[model samples]
Target: MEESDIVKDIEKKTRLTSLKKYMWGPNILNLTLIIMVSQQQFLGRLSLLSTVLLLISIALNGITLIFFSKEIRYEENQQGIHKPFNKLTIRLLIFIIIFFGAITIGYFIR
Candidate 1:
């Protein structure tokens, strides 16, 4: 039961590494969501297809965020030191919240 063995086991069980290709999932989904919303504004019409895509993208992003959060806690625990979150992360979280709220309002407005 070496420390390295424990860390490796944890990683294997969780299947989460911040450096993995899927780490881009959240960013890509976020971009897609914004594009879907913006297209409606420019075209000036309700699009059921865009709405369905937006919901799917948001759900996928939510799953990605859960993995990201788990990885953050896993790394922090392994380091034995709890660090404050990055300013950029905080700003991005805020931006996501505001945009999500706007989307909710837009969904109801139309």
Candidate 2:
């Protein structure tokens, strides 16, 4: 194939890879978090409402991952997962990292 054709092929493959990650990547992380939380004992007492909220959040995360996989798979014929990352996604990811980092620091400090 010509140089232009090769470039196009690479672009196509990269897009496919991105879509695959988008579809399946979150589930892996989500499952890992679930496992860690389930295994590790939480120190101190938590209120019933807090526990319920936590369970709800976990369920929502699982559901979201499932829907994400379905949507990504459904777009198999498309060029790629073309979903635009808006403010909410960006903030959510940032907050997730920051929140986890804070928790880790607190764990160590205690």
Candidate 3:
């Protein structure tokens, strides 16, 4: 089989351009928490470690998304699977919200 055929097969089977599928999980989780934080009731109910994971996930995902967005923007002027600036801005906003929320909860819990 040709190299291009192999790549096409992989892309078709995975339904994501390898990079995207890998990054999607964490980004989606971060977005989930971003939504969670907006709901007042879920704030203190989750365990501290869980909260920590959520915070870290948001941070890492935000950073990853930023890089991903920048790369996408540089690659093509037209839109592809994702919009670079929108994804970056949303992830960043989510990270900020989660950071402040986590700090506020930590103080109250302590």
**Per-prediction TM-score to the true structure, in the order listed:** 0.55, 0.41, 0.48
Q: Write one digit per residue (lDDT tens) for candidate 1, span 1-110.
A: 45697777676545535434465767676766755664565646567776767766776776676667666657656656466766346745765785677577557656
TM-score, model 3 to reference: 0.48
Which candidate, 1 or 2, would have the higher TM-score against the true structure? Answer: 1
Going through the candidates in the order shown, the clash numbers are: 0, 0, 0
- CA displacement after TM-score superposition, residue 67 of candidate 3 (Å): 1.4
Clashing residue pairs, backbone N/CA/C < 3 A, model 3:
none
Candidate 1 local lDDT, residue 19: 38
Question: 1-110 in candidate 3: lDDT tens per residue?
Answer: 45696776565445435546566776677767755544435454666676667667667777777776666554433324445456657756766777687557554654
The deviation in Å at residue 86 for candidate 1 is: 8.8
| Tens-digit per-residue lDDT, 5-103, candidate 2 | 778768767765776677456555565544443433454444546544544565567566556555455454454445554433554575467445534
